[model samples]
Target: MAGTVAATLLVVVAAYRFRSSRQDRSLPARAALPGNVNQQLSGYTFTRSEGGRRIFTVRAVRTVALKQGGTTELEDVVVDVFGREGDRHDVLRTGLAEYNPQSGNFSSRGSVEIELNADPPPGGSNGRQPAYLETSNVTFRQQGSLVVSDAPVRFRAGPVSGSALGMTYATKDGWVELEKDVRVELQPAAQNVTLAAHDPKSTIPFKATAGPGLEAGVVWLTAQRLRYDKDSREVALRGPVELTQGNRRIVAGRGTVFLDSRNRLTEMLLEDGVHGFETTDNSSMSSAERAALRASPSSEPALAHSTQSGPPAHGTESVPWLPGSEVQRERGPLPEALEASAQRARGIFDPASGQLRKLVAEGGFQADSRRGGGDRKQPSVSRLEAEQFEMTFEGVHSEPRSGVASGNVRLSVNSSATSVAPKAVRGGRPPEAKTARATVKVQPATQTETMTAAEMTFDFRAVGRSLKRAQTVGAGKL
Candidate 1:
């Protein structure tokens, strides 16, 4: 899109200057023989060349010189820009255009359409769709390769499409800016892989495996404005940016995306009041705040955190507990799930496999989870608070394997009720298992355990949904 805009702007400016200069220099001889129009030309064609090679061509079906106004109007204008060695090219078309010789300004009266075709990048397939753009009310500055449009613009490249309220392109500096209400959508290439489920019989829970490819997904993004800098190969999204893919979504105050030499997205950075969320199962949701996500094609995308690994101060020791009745009733509505929020959050992902590797939250971090009633005899809730919390995922299923909480770590586990098995009858007389005297008694009690430590580690069970073991290290209390 950027390349096409730059090339089209350059061609339009050059064509206007060249055509108007030639017409103005020859106008004196035809001044006495014309009305308002000095000369009318049909089938006008202009070409620019460098080093004996044609660079671009401009054509018009008809052109009329306005003798009194020193301006020229063109109909059915088309500009064809040739790339190096003629290996690539772009075509620009518009219904009408006007050039002011005195001010050297060029303006388009109707909508402009541009199509760009370029050779495939290294390692890419030979066949690819051309990029297209459409915009109206375009104007070019006379002194520089700057083009601006106050009207809306739409651009499409491959499976990506975008729109903006207004736009500006600077050919000389290779910069493009979308003024307001920028929105983009990308349809990612499909992968035919299925995620592996946890093995029920395996002792080791959540083994990592490179599973089958995943289906293609769509990514949508919106921002107040967007700017692209060719020199740094970066695009910046400003103010109230949002990105959504599948059930996952991220919102931030600002974001920046870096592109590789091939113009592929390689890395991204988001900051300022960031919030991320994902819907797992049922109607529940997980969310985080003040988070940042960094993704790169070459390495795992990572979430960063501040390090804190120590016990709390000597004066702070009290821990709060929930009532037994409340804990029991809460089990009904709360399903097994995880929730976290912090001053900062970071995540890492496998570039090739597109699997999340790890997530780390730091700076006043807190995480909470509720065990599903179906998974355990006693439903329980666990809460952890510390300077940092880290979770690691492994295997083909992308199941969480381990977690660590560090720096003034405090963990609380609350469970409601326990099941008691019925006793067997001594006499073999048709075991009266359902007898009133043989019935199991219900236990109405809540168990609340709290632990404090410098750091704590958790190992997950085979299903990866439940904790198998947890231990604290360094000056710890239970």
Candidate 2:
């Protein structure tokens, strides 16, 4: 009986083990694959080639492929992008990076550093410095060669360093953009000296020194945003922009900077509610509105033009031409040099040397002058208002050749006092007995001369340090 029982027990135990094995075989598949299948690598490097030439390289201390998602994690990553024929080299390094191979999307887990190097083009500066950038949370699209970061970024290129809230870089097209709150400060290698308007027949005037508030060889620019297109060699600044070069300050709603092939500033366009001012000799100030500044390739430095519409309205606020009692009371201290305003203004410049050649202000233009103010006997202020006004500079020195004001021109001269003879003393003495005592009074008066014509021109000549000759041509009341 005991042997039969033991045999039955052994059979029962075997049956139990077989049943457990069957159950284990029927279990669901594992959620994760083995570690070897994920292909984790150490000191991994990747290269992208085009036309049998390596275009870019990616290196990492360690790379791991996630099992659940086909994403790659890289530690201590470095990426190098090569430009045409390896003339340009750009490097990007980050502590950690995440890459989605299927989508060709890559992003930095933390801050990234980028260095961009470019070879100077033929005939360009030989010592161009590499551009460096530091930013956080960067995303890159490999297929499109686009890199973007919404986080703040800091950049440095030679003497220029700036910070921006956001940025985008397109490697394929060489486009770089700062999305908002862009500020740039530059320390120019050389001072950009420009000659003021002078009399061509006379010797060149002494160079005007910078005022107290102005800095030499420094440029500051602030804007809502900035964009640079390498293909077009153009830079654009969006609204509420301000640019300060030396003592000059320009405020505009929007502006654009055109660059030559060598990345030199060639032209600038300011639009919408544009206002610019510069402190001149003495306490005088020169300011303008609605103007365009351009640099020409010739010997002239730059051309500025401003335009306006409609005729001069009656009793409109006049732009002060010079610093005088009235101008001081109304518009504060005036610029010692020439000051002008108009609806539209245009300036001609010599592109090669950045010299101002000519300036034209049209459409209800006005110019005020206190140039000859030392002589109290002469008018303290002289103002000219017309439909259009122009000043031309000639010769290599950019001397003032002539000026013209046309269309309903009016010239007003304001003196400190006017001599008025007492009314007929002989007859007045006899008649005075009937009316108290005859009173003789002299009061200051403003003499105004108006000229209505299709055109008027003034030829200027310099004598000593003042305007010696001014010849006017027009048929009108003077």
Candidate 3:
């Protein structure tokens, strides 16, 4: 039903447009605009062309310019054109290839140049939006739609801006196609992210077709031969998108990226390609930082499921009863150096709990300490090293909200230290003992006081829409 109504409207509008043939334009090729146009400006049309071959016709309004000794000048502005005419024939509106002194450079070669400049009407009621000259090469065929631009064309809109290497406009479909190489460099504004490019063409995105009455305030970008639905708040790079922040840059094969009003990337979708990894050598981030960088969530930090060794592999086990409540060890006690070193090695921690969302680092899987027989006056500790360590953290919100979070850490490393210090009798000097450096290494020969986790993850409800679960396994030396 909608299609039928649209077809009917097109036919009705097309018919009404051709009702009157006001005049004709016989513009001869010349070096400058013909000084006299009252006799030449009469070609005014309420219609497109007779057959759908003609793209547009100009109706020049006569005026006198204050410049050039105050001479009467002819402003040949093309008010309107038939969109269908160009589409049906694949006609391209292009500019002068090489200047020809004999005739005005365009139309004679089947190329057209359109320019328009009119003052805003009183009370800002002018129907004229802004306009610029369009120039390109075109080849129109009945069976095949017209394609413009055998070469790069340019748009000299004004002194500060220009667009080049444009595309085609089909009168039959009323579609203005922008080429893939199209680039546009906008002047920097208070908040606008400016650009620079070549052979750029643009159109309102197709998403609007899904809406009612097509809301305004849209600048559709077609680049790399892809369409984008963009707005002031966010610029969605629908196809492969890339953003260059100060020290971080993200490029996605396919995803929607959310940026702040300042054009900072907030989050994006990071998918593994055929090889399971995407290589990036961003110019912004330092080598160390780029290597350590992880994928930004589609949202924020949320606790994952209840975890045993780490965040559960891929299930609801990541989420605990409460979220974001973490259990951290109280750093204290011991021989000053031993205590500090033990704090570094870790000996005790609250075990994993389903009720408590926890993130912690474990120094060893097992730690045994024996009380002295009383004959011995000193407390003693033995050090054992393990190759690999595990850490876990989870989110549990009694607040009725939680998500995957960098959880509690459970890590163990190999270490060595002085065995025992001999004590002296009260008021007497103690026996002197020689000391050697204590050395320890974890079990698998892969552990250290500082263990680099393969990955740390949390499970949380994300974007308040669905679940957000993350797990990072092996990354660096642990």
Best by lDDT: 1
* C-alpha RMSD between model 3 and the true structure: 22.5
Off by over 4 Å in 3: 1-46, 49-135, 138-147, 153-166, 172-174, 182-223, 227-241, 254-478
Off by over 4 Å in 2: 1-42, 49-56, 61-69, 75-78, 82-90, 93-95, 115-117, 120-131, 156-160, 188-217, 245-247, 279-443, 450-478
User: Rank by TM-score, descending?
Assistant: 2, 1, 3
**Model 1 alpha-carbon drift over 4 Å, by segment:** 1-35, 42-62, 78-92, 114-131, 192-216, 283-478
- For candidate 2, the 10 contiguous residues with the lowest summed lDDT are 294-303
Lowest summed lDDT across 10 adjacent residues in model 3 is found at 334-343
Comparing 2 with 3 on TM-score, the higher-scoring candidate is 2
How far does residue 156 in candidate 3 sit from its true spot (Å)? 11
- lDDT, residue 66, model 3: 29
* Prediction RMSDs, each to the true structure: 17.8, 13.6, 22.5
- Residue-wise lDDT of candidate 2 within 1-478, one digit each (tens)? 9999999999999999999999999998766646744877788788877777666788999988876678888999988776445445567889999888888788985988876554433434434345677889999988778899999888766445678899898765567889998887654432343334433222222233554322444567788999887657668889677666543455557777765555555466666644444323443332331111111011111111112222133322222122334333344333333345554455565545444567666666766555333222233566677887778876534456788777777776554656554454564356545443445556556565444555667766642223444444745665
Can you write out model 3's per-residue Cα lDDT over 330-426, one digit (the tens) per residue? 1112111111111111111112211222212223222222111111122233222232222232332111122211222333333333244444444
Residue 247, model 2, lDDT: 37
**Judged by lDDT relative to the true structure, which candidate is superior, 1 or 3?**
1
Assess candidate 2 and give its TM-score to the true structure: 0.57
- Cα lDDT computed for each candidate against the true fold: 0.61, 0.60, 0.30
Better of 1 and 2 by lDDT: 1
